[model samples]
Target chain A: MSELTGYLRTDGRKGIRNVVAVAYLVECAHHVAREIAWPHRDRAHVIGFPGCFPNAYAQQMMERLCTHPNVGAVLLVSLGCESFNRYALEKVIRDSGRPVKSLVIQRDGGTRATIRDGQAWIESTVAALAEAPRVPMDVSELVVGTVCGGSDGTSGLSGNPAAGRAFDRLVEAGAACIFEETGELIGCEEIMAARARTPELGDELRAAVAKAARYYATLGYGSFAAGNADGGLTTIEEKSLGAYAKSGASQIAGLIKPGDLPPRGGLYLMDVVPDGEVRFGFPNISDNAEIVEMMASGAHLSLFVTGRGSVVGSALAPVIKIAANPHMYERLAEDMDVNAGRIITGAASLDEVGEEIYRLVLDVAAGAETRSEALGHAEFILTYKSFEPIGPACLPA
Target chain B: MTTTDTRLLLLSDADNVLVARATIEAGETIVVSGTPITLPARVIMGHKLARRTIPAGTPVHKYGAPIGTATEDIAVGEHVHLHNLKSNYTATHSLDAARAGAEGQEP
Candidate 1:
């Protein structure tokens, strides 16, 4: 019923943009990978892990990311000495029916030769991707992720709930929406559990938040940052309540991990906190990391709500920045897409901003570039982490 | 300016503190429920101001939920932040103090 069209992939998923992902297998290959994608930076992006040590979770994340619907092709740049299984990752991309190539700096006559060869592949692949089929797409087929960063007191009051309003509209229209950060959801778990579709799912939701609370307790830090206090936010629970507003009022359909896709259109919670004994230093290193995780789970776009202001965008998906502070909004006008801060100034109501977000989502899906996308903000990040499979209670059959 | 111009926003009905929609100056008078109250100090935008007298160790409410407990007695219209409030579950850290002093917000 929507006027949107998308690039059709072999996996039956549609992509808003056919991005060429130039992935480096480890830190050693980062420079070469960056150079190869620099000429076609608008269409190609660099992403990868820095660790030489292999982790099953990192491998799985890379596989999901390479095969993500938005990615039309992938180039694996390996230093050859790292333990990352570049061949396996390359095969996964090839099997997914996208063009795949690999270059080893150690074997391909070092930096200059590897870059020269990698750029040629990218140049040709970019030409081929322009011809990828465009099929009709709908809101129901779109997956959106919402996250709040650099939040202040105004975040919950204005921007977050506005985004939540948009999420409500999207979910009502049968679109899949994901809201994450279980650590931030600490104070709101019972309320979140009450909205679960099933009693068993409610238990899972509670357990996940419980795990986050314990995890942070062991880490000797809450998710609360120093900037948060500088902006008048005193505690983590207060921040959780504000962040929880982004989930909207839809019934919780399921709980998912970083790379897990929602079975159908509804709202799902991504358990971002790492399972086990804090093997990974933090659940997500920064805002960009969580955005990457959302893209790995098939999110076509993300709504980033910021009061203190964040300018970062994702490599594969577009980010729509919603400014929560009016003063900060004026200071960073070019970086903002939605001025939710207007709600506080009495220029716009909460629902108006919400409706505005709804329209913007549809407009963006129709190939309109977000401010970040227009400003050349294809920022990316990935770190080591692990996840156990989701239990039956997490997703209702 | 019009009286409709909100200098402070009460997020939830059960909230005990009102968030400053704009930076309110020290000694500025703000009408709350038709009673004009004078602020003793400035409240920055996105910061909290006490709606009523709050005793030591009472939960401070925002968005109708307990954000943390008050560290000391807080009077009406006073700024409520890390100096006076702390999380019940975990301690908040800031630049100055090692435990429960400042941060904008994070999740």
Candidate 2:
């Protein structure tokens, strides 16, 4: 295996992409932050929460994202009166040995001046990050995540299983692979639980899906969309069966919540559903929210499998799109990176596509831009959700 | 045994449906379980086709697991979709209702 070079962080994590993240503390300061990041589009990304209400989960998510290994520096754009803990967020990023700065719009003479100052800070930060030393990084040191969206029937048979094969290869190589969206894994709970490394972990995996089913039930939906039905998926269970294929056939190492890094390198399930009553409308309101959760868990990049096609990339980590439906792939060829749909067409076998995905992952980690990245699709979203920490059994020492 | 033809695929031995690898128009004849049956309706690519006669209320098996329960008797080669199958997890939220709900309208 060949080695790849990455930016080394004080937290002992190696980042494939070193980004200067300009985060708006509230929606009020979004435009100013966006203006500041507009010029440094290649190396700087804009991310933030829209709500002004103080949400512990949102705050924690921001903190985790700011300190993410991929982030080399951070600029906080605060609206002065928002309840977000800018000082604490800045402190976390600073402690991570990354350059950190905060610009309060109200204190900095409003939009124009704040934008100027934020732009100046971003420029300086990017310059400083450019000089950051690169070190040899191992595949085992990487954290990869998988999610399926806009899925159709062909997704399970093609894109999802092909991604699963890639996941299996990564896991066998000692990489930490994560597959989530318990809401989509409703019917495959029994089969998924059977792959757990421990009986307790199996129970945890089963309970997570059960929670998702009950949660979606109260919401009067099963995470099934009309497009899914239009794509020939008859039920949520069928969709779940396809969605579960992304995990491959590796033994699930543990169950984790957002912001909880894997204890060791192996396959893990991210329990995204919030604990307690369904206060939040849905566990994941959109595809990006699931991507955000995966990013918080320290994923370096995410493999997004889509059948109907989705053109989304993350603010921090790059997103690799694997097209499932051959027809959709042809229609959205510009947005997709891998043609997993070829499996169904018999032009390529699952293992061939799997190897292609694996090679693309390494290439992307080595600085090859994914189709989403090339298209400048840096979509990010965060919302309110609550969760109790994982039990010791969830991640054995 | 699996078919060498790319137009249709049987995912597993336990699956009662064969997924259409390509669109099969109405009146098209396809072989399933070594028996030829004419498609009763158009089956879009990625859609399922009944492999055998199934009774209503019987759990629909795909990938060797029950995906949903059939709501009406399904004959071989008929399209297996929402019209005759219902999810066992949540009550059927029709395409219109789902679209309306996604757009913030009560359905």
Candidate 3:
């Protein structure tokens, strides 16, 4: 058994970091939330929805994020006019047995009062969190997520495949590993479906990818970014193949939406695309949005593979940045945690890099700071979207 | 998987393109599939080159998967990018028009 330990939550889930989440319910309350967490930024983080309109998806995501294993306490900051049911969110966090307090700009005075009150709450909460019980946590109890951003040709040949190998190792150790966004896995549906744990789940996998293809076709744009082309990725298909490499070669145990936690330890596919005619402009407005969705699904930490380089980290869960390009790694070494780029430079093999990533995951879980985390990069974003409850085929008993 | 001071990597035997393991200059020559071809232009690291002469409309392979079809007859050592390669599903988005705006293409 591994010797790592974490903060044990009331739900029996363990947290690698006991983060005090200062959440803004709407855009108007964002400034107050940021100011509250700004001083105690090391222990407290700011996260929120900018939407003035009510969205069930946003509400559910907020609830899941507030009660995520990594979070110790939550402070909700609301503008008192947003449609986002802040009371319902506060109730959920309170029900989860965490110390939750709310400050409405209208009810609890304006920005100055709210910021003063919120900062006081975070201070007490951080001190209280220090007394939280440290319980034994195993690698098998971990939930790991991976997303590739700023991708290029070498991403597939080096970092991505190496990440896949790492995923294989994680799954082998009985950890729940999730790889996602059917939009990015467009061209690999056939190959991905073939690796499903069940034949029925395979069909669900194919339909999810097909739905993504249709969704993007209607929008007139794939997830391809302009930086992708400059990084030497030619088409969405090519990029899809590279992105799909992060999943590794393992039997996909289940399929899930943004907030659906995996029932067991195995590989899962997260469908970030919204259900019913794509009303949302894009499935994920930014890469951080994707990481937020993974956090909602209970990912304790994330492995971000980037070829062109991305310096983003998540609020609740720590994000481990894996540099895919040797040249890019050399330039962004301070921002990077693992160098899968060594595979490209012939300094290491895929398995060697993969092993390095696995060890780093454990080390980070044991309280070692990632480069992004060390630099205080706690980026987060959430938006409106809807999803039908996952079907039975999604999780096989 | 061999990378002993190599400038190019042929990811799969089924692939018709070779990826630059490191940036290669225009005058550089590399052997591929037992045939030597001089680089027609500087190939940046993580960029692709036609490993063999790819006929127009043929699928381009990388990582042993079909990435997209070639839009023109690409010669060996020619840089394979958006100029000659197009996605079969949808058009790849680029900010060229905004760059055209840089060239004063927009008012």
Candidate 4:
């Protein structure tokens, strides 16, 4: 394994990079959020949601994001009329000892003045973040997650398996690695179950995937994307077989819901699909929503595989794009990290590409910005959804 | 890493076809399971070639997995995908109807 290093945070967690974030509580606050982030653009970013109504999922997502290890300081821009829990979110960040400030549009005399005040506060916060001392960090303290979007034929053979190799390396180094979208794991239940450390844990793993399928079926969707069909994939079962490969070869440590943190270090499944009747349209509207949940659960970085070319990055975590199709990789070389499609082209072995990805993870973890991050693609989204709390079987021993 | 006389041309390994890795011009001989067969037309990369005579409604296989079902009887070396095969999981049609209006859909 290559030697790894990172910027250590006050929480004893290692951050791949230090970034300041300006958050808009609702669509109405987006402008001020952007304005505040603009002045400190090099070190600061604007990230927010467009929803107006109060959502438990959104609030929880916001809390997790504002306090993410990568963010050294946060500025919350509230419309002052929206129902988002801005105060609670501010408190979470403040309590974590990171610099945090909330600017309410209503109290600050609307957009113009709020932007002025917000920018001033953000500039000062950025300075403070810059002055914060960086401590020594280790590889074992890292948390990573993997998700695939725009999958094609090479995904199962190359991209996902390559990510699995990286996950295996990360886990062996004592880092927490997570792979999710249980809705896509429908057909791999038996295969996934066999990898669990214990029979009981194996059964729980299968049950979690079953729950995701049932939840999606309630919405009349099968987690089958149109792109899957376009890429020579034929069935949800076939897609599941590929999607389940992202978990790597680690023994299943535990099963978890969207926001639940792993109790101990090992590979875990994140069930992003909601429980009960599907009140919300789909579990996750886009790929970034799933990425957000994994970040909230403490993944410091994300490995994103795209066969059809996805150019998205996360707001708080750096997203490493692994292109699975050789043609797609050639077309989108500027936006990708490692091209697993080389395996299909027979230019590289699966293990070779996998090792490349594994090495890339350590480099990205040690402060090398990914193509998506350098392009400032901080795409984030949170939606309305309800989840029945997990039962005892979901946690590890 | 290239194997001689063993293309191992897998198409679900359950179906009766070899998926095209590149465009196979008509009359070009390709090896599958050490058996040399000629192409009927231009078979695009990512498309499939019939491993054997495929009957209509038979499930098409790739990587030992069923990708879709055949909509018509396909002769050996014929291109498979939206034109000849359709997805059983989702109601996607053969290659033509599926790729209709969305040319260059693949990267």
Candidate 5:
């Protein structure tokens, strides 16, 4: 493998993309922050929490996102009265050796003045980040995440397994690969548990999925969507089985929650379901929420597999969309990066497509713009949630 | 037109349903497990089709696991979709209704 160059952070982490994040503390400030990012869409991205009330999970997630390796600087836009701790978030970013500035609308005059000030700050940050030193990074330094959205029957047969194949190769090459959505993995818990590195970890895996099952049962809904059924997926378990294919064949290293970085490079399962009673509505309200959590765990880039077709990108990291159904790929060719549907059509084998996805990862890491990035799909979202810290066994020894 | 040998994918030997890699028209002949059967209805690409006779209330296997229970008897080559099958976990809301709700019909 060739050496890849990335922006070197003072904390010894490397960023594949040095992005200037414009974050709004509440929904009130979202418009101004978004206006600031609209012109410099390629260099700056908008990310924030919409709630006026305080949420520890949201705060922790924002802190992690601001300090994410991909982020070189942060511009916080606060409406001046929201409960989010802007001071603490700024301190965390500054502690990571990245430039951070917070603009409060109430204190800074109004919307027009705040937008102008935020835009000016964003420009300078981008310019300064352009001068940041670039250092050679290894595959082991890369944290990659995989997720499936708009899934169909073909997702498991093609896109997901192809992503799994790529994940297996990346894991073998000593890269950290993460797969998430415990609620979606309910039916395949037994099979997935068997792939855990140790028996205790396997038990943890089963228990996590069991908790997800119970939580969803209480809500009277599965993560399974109406579109999932329209695309020939019958049940949540079937979707879980399909979603499970993205883990590849490697022994799962450990399980981690959102914002918990993997100890070392290998396959890790992200337990996204909270620890207590069903509190946060549905864990992940949407696909972007899942992507945000993965980014919180330090994923440099994400591989998003879709059969019904999804066109979503992240604020901190880039997303590579892999199309599973040949028909959907035909319809949404401009949005997809990899056409895993060829595996089903016999035009390409799984290994061939898998290698294509793997090479694309390296290429994207090397500064190639994903289709979503080029088209400017920097979608971000954070919501209310609660979680008890993960147990020690969750991380590999 | 492609034959079933190229257009249908059997995920595993244990799977009782085959995924349609491409759209298969009604009356099209499909071979599964060395037996040739004519499709009873058009199966859309990415959808499932019964590879063997599945009686009503029997678990329908795809990817080698039960995806759902058949609501009615499904013959070989019959399309297995929402009409004849349902999720074992929860009642699936219709896409049209969900879309309507999403577009401010409920709020």
Candidate 6:
């Protein structure tokens, strides 16, 4: 399958959209960042971390995001005195050959003055980005990620498995499809491992689930929350079985932590848990954080499956929502892209909805705006965490 | 001697039990390994029931793996839920108890 033409970046990467970013360095800088993006709307989008505390993980995440494929330029809105490493972060973006500017509210006259300067920079950046070169894209060059949130009883039977169908088709088409949150794959570890391409890779898959189990056990909870329980899931492992179906039946290509790119086009698992210890409050504070990590790993688009419903989209990627429950689908029809619930009600088959999702992925990659993106749901969040490097066995050879 | 009715789904040959696709009623006749017997209770769709008579605390198998253990003796077609089965590591509740707890709690 040939991909549609995409915007070619100065660094030789291709993007479906050219977006200008406004990032808040701390909670204090959030309001200014929001105000700056509020007027531009489509052209300028807001993304940021709020913790005043310095985190290597946060610093790394910021660097990856500012240089992501969809980002044409960056405007860093800092409180000027926050502990974040803004200088180094901005340098990373500039080094990628993208336009970047930093506004330290403390250094600039004040909020009113900085907003004025930020708007001027954004307006010019938008103009220059309009002139950025366009080039033909290859289907194999795409990185797609999938996630399921707000799951109800029907998620596994419909939305998740339908996402699995789309994932399988995407991988067959040579797109690097990623499914993550190892913590949610706890009970399905054995089955997941058996699907790995090689026996060694199989062991690595099992170990990742074990790590998630231990990590969550220490916290006295599984990746499951109160909402999941309210939605008819009885135990952690039951939730695991349903969540794991989104991975599809593809062979595991490799395991990558946040900020590590997949080696090639295949299915990969993003280990959202930190490499060691339980110091971080939780692996991810919300679904958006997981989406951000997927973007950092080079996902050009995301397939978000929801049962209870979430209307979140990424700043640099299009999010296609597959509604899991028919009731929820009826309520959020305009907000969602596909209703996998039709499979449960007998209106459609899993393969049909899956094909619908697969078609939507291509349609979005070809430049259609997702409902979330159209409604201005550019939600982003990052936080403090620590990690050691993955061992040699973590990835397939 | 006449033949009896049975439904089988081998997800994989290695699997010990196959999942029930539709509800099976109590006292309904089923034949496994050429032996005909009546069901103990109604087995709901998507829920696992024993392929054989599994003793108490034996791991209940599904998807070719152990999902949980039988809390009480589970016969073929018995409703396998909180009363007769529980999650291996955590707790599970039957819809009845869950609904009762819901009704008992005042808003």
* DockQ-better candidate, 3 vs 6: 3
Over A109-180, each residue of candidate 4 has an lDDT whose tens digit, in order, gives: 998999899888877777777766666666677889999998765677678888998889889988888999
Candidate 3 off by > 4 Å: B1-5, B96-107
Q: List the residue pairs that clash in candidate 6.
A: none
Per-residue lDDT of model 1, residues A143-244, tens digit only: 999999988878888899999999999999999999999998988888899999999999999999999999888887898878787777889999999999
Task: Please give the distance, in angstroms, between residue A72's alpha carbon in candidate 3 and its true position after superposition.
Answer: 0.9
What are the candidates' C-alpha RMSDs? 2.9, 3.2, 3.1, 3.2, 3.6, 4.7
Indicate the residue-level lDDT of A2 in model 1: 88
DockQ by candidate, in order: 0.49, 0.42, 0.46, 0.30, 0.34, 0.15
Question: Candidate 3, residues A58-79: lDDT per residue as tens digits?
Answer: 9999999999999999999999
- Chain B TM-score in candidate 5, rounded to 2 decimals? 0.73
Better of 4 and 6 by TM-score: 4
Calculate each model's fnat, 2 decimals.
Answer: 0.65, 0.56, 0.68, 0.19, 0.42, 0.06
lDDT tens readout by residue for model 6, A96-127: 88888999998998899999999988888888
The DockQ-based CAPRI class assigned to model 6 is: incorrect
Model 1 DockQ, alpha carbons vs. true complex: 0.49
Candidates' lDDT values, in order? Answer: 0.89, 0.89, 0.89, 0.77, 0.87, 0.78
What is the alpha-carbon lDDT of model 4 when measured against the actual structure?
0.77
DockQ ranking of the models: 1, 3, 2, 5, 4, 6
Q: Roughly what TM-score does model 1 have, to 2 decimal places?
A: 0.96
Please state the CAPRI-style docking class of candidate 4: acceptable
lDDT of 5: 0.87
- Superior candidate under lDDT, 4 versus 6: 6
